[model samples]
Target: MRNFLTAIFSKDKSPFVNAKAATSWCKRLQEIDMQSQHLKIHAAVTAFVSEERPTTLDSLSALLLIDDAAQPSYEAVCYQYIANPRMSKEIESRLWKQITSFAVDMAGVYQLFVQSETESGKKAEFALLMPKVLARSLHYLSIQAKWHYFRFEKVPSKLWTLSHQLYRLSEIEGCDSNPFPLYTSHAQEVTSCADEYIQMLMLGSLSNNNLSVRQIDWVDQWLNQWSKLIQMSRKFQEGRYHLCVNLQAPEGVQKIQAESEGEPFRYWGLHDLMHELEETLRRLENGATPRDLGMGKECPAPLAVELLKHLDIFWLMSIRNSVVQRSERKKVAKIADIISGLDSIIGHVRFDNDKNVRKASADGRGQVDYDEIMDMRLYGFVSTRTKEKPPPNKVVENKQKDWHVWNIENESVGGYGAVVHLSENEWVRPGLLVANRLGRQENWHLGVIRRLNRLGDDEVYVGIQSLALSPIAVSLYMEKEERKEQISLAEDSTLGVADLPNIRTALYLPHQIEGKNVNTLILHSADYGTDKIYRVQARERVFMVRLGSVIEKGVDWVWVTVFVISQE
Candidate 1:
């Protein structure tokens, strides 16, 4: 009450008083009562003494100018706490929440501006509002996006300037905040949906081998949901940041209008979304793990399909432009053909370097060579669209040999080599191995040894194991196994397939993935391929282990453990 009186006597109403002047007052108060922390409380109570609430008439006359320059002081306070441990822990905690609150509110303002201008058809207002709203929007998004990227991916940089700018554009174009919570909640939704779609794609990719009809339906559903969610997210961003304000106006307030001025904002909004979606797809394919960005391990297939779809659209658009420009039809046709061919090739070709080769001396006394052959198979047509029912399981013939001698020159014998040619369609399963000879060459023995040793040059060994031990549960495990060693786990019979270690990894599932109450797990191992003793099963929900990864010579194997599903 005494402090309240002090505020009533004081002159300023601004939240922040000069710290130097306040410090002396604080010191004096501390001497009065160490337990008393009423400075701010008193300040709040007396804040209204000198400040009068705006009257209804006055409010009507005043412009609601969102002061973008008036950055919330909460951010500075939080930064202070983050940079200094000497500050009171209580102060830090309070500041963190305040900062987050300020950020959300600030973003809301920009969103409001973007939405208002776009809907109003005030092109001039939108043009004028664009730089300011976008600037602030980018600022806020960069901060949040960086936090996520850092927490999840451990990316050092906190700012993706380009992405921030694009996000601003997206927001102005149109993004909704109704469905998900503002911060991580919204982020999680986008990532989780993306992940689900990816999973569907993966299942579809694997379906040609042995997946069931029900499994295919699940994939299709995922794809549909994934496309819709992405579309929604894209719409939100585009709608929020795209404002083309006019320069000439009576009140100097420009309004936003469509490029053509005939159509509504939705077209432009969708266009912006498409641009961002394509960019995101490109990033995922290139394996660029941006900071705080959580893209779930959904199959790459859907992404590929989406990208191809856009590519086709872009191609048609480009062709239209070319025709208008009177550009050479033949050149345009060739470009389109190339794009179509690339789309088909990427759709069907999946390359994996998972096999290793080992050879010994003529007398099997010393290590002669060890190589790993990365596998790549070509399919006639592989759709990115999810299928409702998985194709019937079939044993696709793998018409390739375990080892092919390209060139062999023995220490004591003549050089002789021949290429192994594929004569039939190969049924390549999840764990199948297949190899073809490059061609015949002189010094066949030496060439074979060299090729085998070369596998060591580009080998990344990941181990997978699953076993049925009981009727209830199947255990699973995954671990990074870098060195070669003889590792073993008992196969439980009663539990059915207990676990499948590194199975998700084998299927290229993302780390820290969860689905339908199924927990993915990981284990360490020292083996790979047909040589590794393990089984694969799907039915009763089982524990999946995705290991905490540590980088090794890119060629290390992972260990995993799994046990049967158990009601007990």
Candidate 2:
């Protein structure tokens, strides 16, 4: 009598009455845009999966159709947030909550199907559903992991524990190696539960704390193709294999030990993955185009090589131990001023006539009657009469407003770990180049944001890596005929004033003395060209130099090694 009541209740609790109803719902969802569809689908799916009774096959059919329809919306949401990490907190929070809830709901629905099939004593149905269940569960779990990493937040332990448990369940069911369609968009592309698990492990092994959001996205995309090369095993191998994960550890992949002490662990031998990466690097170094090497056209060979090399070192080498010792100290540091972009940094460091430009009155008109257009232009405001855009390397005006105050929680030789309560308009992320000075200090130092963690709605913790101690601003001119003509005019002038063309503003890092042969120059990204020679004007000295390989690059600046051609 109890079983009969349970059956009746379960049948009534199913989300869809029949398969036709589910099909019609999916068809209707297709008519709407992806952004709107996600909200509706999420709401309905959440309600359906929240039922108390066991999920039925009819509901499973609806769930599968819903999952298929939700893929595009899911991808759209992930791309939106990952591509624009600095979006408004309200929108970001909403998207994060929705996407996270959707992933959890989908994973739970699939887990229910697995449980229901197993308990029904239908071996054939269980066998058919096992691979799909594991694949979908891991897929959604990977999405959750990526969103967490993009925000630089710690992924919950339950996520990893459940991921491991799912893969283990697949292995026990003898379907871990079976192939299934992972996505509706790419129905022909089949993958196994093992491959999905390997991809998760690879993602976990990345040094996400050090990589930019875009870099993390690239690694995630590339792993879709690269994870197939990795092989997993139950037995521990020697030097060729090192990475492993304990199924019961509730953590990510780590270095394997010779003996596991009878714990359930899976080992992944990265020999093949490393070999492929090394070969790709060699091909790239041999002048093979990125497109020819199967990388997209937008991917430069150098960038591809850099990413591959990073992955190679991360996978093959043992875990790195930090050598720099940090000290905890409580102190207030006025971020005296913060500046990003080569133009902004140069503007702050250099003396320019723009600072002397006349100010605008209450009506937004220049006070000075003479040279009104020139004054407005110098003030870095768009003029209706001129309609001229600022030069690419022009210095920005009125930078004092970019300052922030922080509490330095720790100090080290390399950088500082500071926390700040940021205003709505202010934003910071990893890979941002910043110039900071201590409170009441006149000297400014250059650094890059290496890590960032949100402590709360308005509070953020940042790890900065100092680049130089006393960088001086300088003018760099292309060594072309126009520049040579300007130099001749200066030499021939009685007043020693030459009307030179607008040259690039670059930061000369005096502390980055790379021996007597090489120096470092931080120049605007647009101003950097391969093998370009430049005449650099310092305070009292002038020299000609040729740019070498790029040491590092950001959205607006490039740190390139320079070789001295001559000194005047």
Candidate 3:
């Protein structure tokens, strides 16, 4: 009442003063005694303020701008309360809710701008009237088609830098908000393909709010692209790298001495091969004198050929007597061929080094699974798009997730082996960011897809390396009964995050990686203090992880260690 009287009677009631008064009133509402009464009173007050203003697109845009303008003052006041422990926390929670709520609402507005079929063919002529809608629509469209690369993927799933593009386009072309310089041109350039039909729809978006989409065809196009990639990636989903191999090449063929361009080796000697075979057998027999295969005496070429012919017939007969499951040798080869072509985009083929050389000493059937392997049912959610340098602890928060229920095949210290269905595994890939949660628990562990394996026609077993567990829930104050009753309760929480200060580092991987992959990544200064992002170049699987990050004094230097996790 005293504050209200001051607002009415005092000389100063300027825009800033009125805004300050409104903010103070809102802040005071937090101090109301009863939780129920507190929420109810504030709700009534807010509803009253909103009552006079109808929330059209324009009104919402105005409110958003106003909220943004007032944010700094709220933050300043929040900072002022830093020394007061309780009030500091209370102020922070209020600020977070305001900011988060605004963001959530703004996201809805942007989505509406792109998706509103009713608003098709509407020319956004007046910038002052519809700046938010126009700006966001143009921004999102540019992001979908990166300056150089055009993603055939879903719009919301893409990432890009469009602030400069939007500003320039808005100022220069005066088409929509920021005219997409190459969006329409790219469509015209792809006239050779039958997919020109799809490109036409893209052109519609580039021109105006006229998105003339054929729903069935659009879905088919999206699914077809995803399906082909998934089919190519299936072999990789299973423990594809652990395939059994014959260590020594089939013997007895007449040596074909050959040399190719830049070949490291040429003309491997027959005597050297025989000696190598004898030595390997001696080691296998545990230093017992190996049964000599007459390697000491060279057999005539005719006799060697005859022996090899008989051996080939025997091997063919053994394969004919093999198990009922058909070999996927041809399909595996097809997958590898396709993957090899796209090695520049998706990561290179990473082979597992689980050389079960110990199996030669065993019964040769294969190692058995132990009972201790935890069989927990869980869901793994994969992020749709790739990130070069993701923000810290925000892979999951950065949306558009496709999730699948997977059976945890086994558990390890820092990782887990899980099986996902064909529909699910299609989206999963090595080095891709993923979130794993056991059952329905909200708790999630952020990680990378370390490996993928295919079992048969349906299932894909994947290896996951956990980086960090999701932040702890702050709702511990609520009892189980209370939680059940008030599941949709308006909760207040504070993030104890420090200010972001710039720092620098160098990219020097501590682990041993293949020579080809080692030099592929060059950690740019722009990526310093960014999230642990996964980026692969050719065969190079790259990401940055911090070992001892601290805000150092004097130089403001923060040392974040980088790592390249791969198998040789």
Candidate 4:
């Protein structure tokens, strides 16, 4: 058996025998259109790298060539999955595992090369390899961090420890400040080991901050420029700087504490970076072009300002201290059987109409069964168009199979941290609007999902921010002059004013404060227009209102303030 195994192993040859060979192989792999084929090729390369254990200068050159060539495909797959909320769980898991394994294997190979040169007492080779080692190791670590951040999950402690150890290793070799050309297709930008280290630290600090996938991507893009402006050193710097990292701790960068003591710690100040960001923001606000100010070409001025403000808060204070305190509790809550959207929220909240109430009373029940309500609402609410005026676009059918039963793991003034079986709610994602009924309560409160993290294959945790305690269902009609003209030209002059067309379903949320006259409505994204007037019909009351600025918006809904023009 030993002889046979040796023969089989000896027959296995490395595709990366030389730099040119590695490049050719990578080009062939890139030419393959199927992602599944790429996965197969990646697996084979990974196995060879891990098991063959090539330990020569020629092998190092080939490995670097392969790394540069393979990165684009791996990152493309990673972002493709991250941006898609409705991706299959099985495919996501399989692809993510392969990508992460590739990163780990690549980083390990580079680290091994550094170790081999150091132990062999080859000073010249070691000096030449140190900067590449630091840059590649940090780049791979950043990939791991990006994986977690995009998934809205916390990075593992072991990963943080490994990152800190790499930065510490660079310090020991006196090459922490050595510059190397980081691979990019656009320009040959030079970066140091310290810059990469700080980028990792900044990424770690953003965990649990409830940033959406797009916002996280924006931060990652801006960090490429912002990280260059940051300064790190062993000595404490003057000014209002609070960022520090302890090399001995199994954590990333954190707020500096006056009383805490730790050796071999690095203090990084963001004062200079903050100044640059503020200056750029000022120019943007004053009508400066984003590309001219070094921002991304596609990024708008408002988005640039929003991202800058978000970063400013983190640089000025500790995220842990800034977060709201959540009360730890284990209580089960009954979630409604409705997919998140303006239509679903309105349907669920308005289920107890006069007709349903009368039917329940006649049957000797206080209210109808929630499950029956869901069934009726889902299948029986298709809208029909009239010959004169067609109804607005029909609401999409709800796809939920059953009610979500979530366990309230924690609670705070703003929201609840809940967990449910992943199989029960595969569509749950950030920015999803949900309706929850707690403990047999008749009234259902509305909330939006702000964060989501999978515990494993079976369960998922989500953070939901409460929006409204008791949202009232209302119908809205665009208050166009043409609408008034149509009403006047009706065949039957007795046609009521409420019988107009283009009625859109919306939710009316009352003011939170008792003496405030503020009114807000959650409407479908298509129904909202700047400065458009709307006639609101709420059960027995009718009023004319005008749309105000949008407070928040999602894929399917928009929350906007409204002013009551007149009540009848």
How much is the lDDT of residue 122 in candidate 2? 53
Candidate 4 lDDT over residue span 1-568, tens digit each: 9999999989635656767777677777765764654575567567766586666666677777776766667667876766775779898787678768777777777777777766776557557766777778888888788777766566888888888888888888888888777665433667788888887788767755556566776677777778888777777654544578888778776656663344767777666877887788778879998788766675677887766665654454342332334445445454443336677668766753322322334466654333233223323432221112222233343334345667777776677888777677767656567887664434668888766556764667788878876677888766565467576758566775545565688988754434554678989877889888887876544678889987666556778888877865
Each model's TM-score, in the order given? Answer: 0.22, 0.59, 0.22, 0.57
* Residue lDDT tens for model 1, 82-103: 4454657687556544544445
Off by over 4 Å in 4: 1-102, 112-129, 143-156, 167-181, 184-339, 353-403, 409-413, 439-441, 481-499, 511-517, 529-531
TM-score of 1: 0.22
Q: What residue pairs clash in candidate 3, if any at all?
A: 237-452, 237-453, 238-452, 238-453, 238-454, 239-453
Please identify model 3 stretches exceeding 4 Å from their true place: 1-49, 52-68, 71-96, 105-129, 134-568
Q: Mind sharing the TM-score for model 3?
A: 0.22
- Per-residue lDDT, model 4, residue 218, is 69
- Quote the RMSD, in angstroms, for model 2: 13.0
Top TM-score model: 2
The per-model lDDT (C-alpha) reads 0.29, 0.69, 0.31, 0.68
Q: In order, what is each prediction's RMSD in angstroms?
A: 24.9, 13.0, 30.8, 11.8
The TM-score between candidate 4 and the true structure equals 0.57
What does the lDDT come to for candidate 4? 0.68
Clashes of each: 126, 0, 6, 0
